[model samples]
Target: MIRQTGATLTGSREKVLQAAAEMIAEDMGTNLSVRAVAARAGVSTGSLRFHFPTQRELREAVLRRIYGRLVSDDPILDRSVPPRDRLVSCLRQVLAPAGVGAEARRTWTRAYEAFLVPEPTEQVRDAYLAYEREGLRRMEYWLTVLADEGALPRGDHTRAVHFLRTVLNGLSLERAMPADDQILKTETETLFTAVDAVLGPATT
Candidate 1:
């Protein structure tokens, strides 16, 4: 067990968030606190505060850390690629298991469970809301870009974004539930097929 008294303070922001995320990802955020997170990050509480001033801020940061790949990285949005292809890449990452990369799907499973509790702290509830909001914003941004390129059929961007997200979430749950590999593959194809039906093929 690492002692807090021996805590190190040279941690980077990304390192601190990564440590906090791992801690929560393993134990469902019950171990989330400045002292605990700092200890895991090898930093003192004061140092953690230097990076994130409030506990709420720290929790929010952890949420972002978990979803950062979806929020920050886009490998297929280049103009050189077909807009449909780019959109498919975006959807794959957005719906990929948190476990698909370095994370465990259980991490996100706990998050979703938390969202359904009878009651939650305002901060916790807001964290969930902010997460979904950020995802939708990213989806909308991509859809708008595709629309501007005449890749998608003319339609309501808001409705399109919402519908696509709903479909993605449902399909994600199928695999996230530990569905059979073949079922997962089939559902994934269904997802792309639905996308094509809604967005139509890329235009000239």
Candidate 2:
């Protein structure tokens, strides 16, 4: 009876997590409330609360789930590829979803309107932070993998990850703006430079 009850609780938690992941994928800033997720999962608010307890816990759980799906087949795990090449591919993948030209512009425009133009509510702010934290987590993981393979020196990667992410964010924003063919060339050059700096002589 205890095992059966535990299984039911686990099932309920997975359902709620799936609902939250769907909501996050649909929109980063909205549709993450307990009420909304419970309705989507076809579960009771009380059940979600019993499992997650706080908004932070719910968001973190959903972020991990989403990140797992995003990077489950990541090339970083493919030792056949040169570590530098793998890292470049990883960086480019960050901008792939945003598209280019008009599509990128639209993506950035929507983000500005949602989180920048108006003061974001508490929930919106929390959701945004969750995404940022997840990004950092991913960067750290990539750096660790490289270090494990002796392609990178093992040390605190916090600042290096932050720098890489900042560069990627800038490049992502640049994609939304008007630019010529030179931009693409420069973007690749920029990634190479960042990776070179972070990985030092190892990548060469």
The TM-score obtained by model 1 is 0.66
Candidate 1 weakest lDDT stretch, 10 residues: 2-11
- Model 1: residue 64 alpha-carbon error in angstroms: 3.9
Q: Identify the candidate with maximal TM-score.
A: 2
Residue 79 lDDT (model 2): 92
Point out where model 2 deviates above 4 Å: 1-11, 201-204
Local accuracy of candidate 2 as per-residue lDDT tens digits, 74-100: 888889988888888888877777877
Clashing pairs in 2: none
lDDT of 2: 0.85
Provide the overall lDDT of each model, using Cα atoms, as 2-decimal numbers: 0.68, 0.85
The regions of model 1 sitting more than 4 angstroms off are 1-10, 28-31, 55-57, 69-73, 98-113, 147-158, 176-182, 202-204
TM-score of each: 0.66, 0.87
Model 1 Cα displacement at 116 (Å)? 2.8
